[model samples]
Target: MRYVISFIWAFMLTQMVNFVLNSLGGGSPYMFWSGVALAVIITATIAIFDVMLKHPDEENEAQHNH
Candidate 1:
């Protein structure tokens, strides 16, 4: 479920970047780079949030395993 949400966020961000670039008459290479940057930023943000907001059960399991 987290993976799905991340994918959705990345996709939406990429599309938004593409749209803005297209409206400004950006070239293909520019659009590609914009999309890549957005993807990276989104992925990193999601990872940070996931780490900060861990599930209760996952935390318990980690403690037990350790």
Candidate 2:
């Protein structure tokens, strides 16, 4: 269920950016590449933030500090 929601959210965001690019002065290639770049950045950012939140490394590091 969570994965489904994430996928929908990502799709909506990507499409919104793509639409805006097309509306602006960008060509088809620019729109396509920008949309791809946006998707990759958003996905990576969410994944990294989720990981850090779920497992804070400072706690693990302190445990090993002994």
lDDT of 1 by residue, 1-66 (tens): 876678678978797868786878855344566676777788888888988999999999999999
User: Quick one: how many clashes does candidate 1 have?
Assistant: 0
Clashing residue pairs for model 1: none
Clashing residue pairs in all predictions, respectively, total 0, 0
Which digits, one per residue and each the tens of the lDDT, describe model 2 over residues 3-66?
A: 4466568767897878876778555554565666667677777777877787667778978997
Worst 10 residues of 2 by lDDT: 25-34
TM-score of each: 0.55, 0.52
Q: What TM-score number comes out for model 2?
A: 0.52
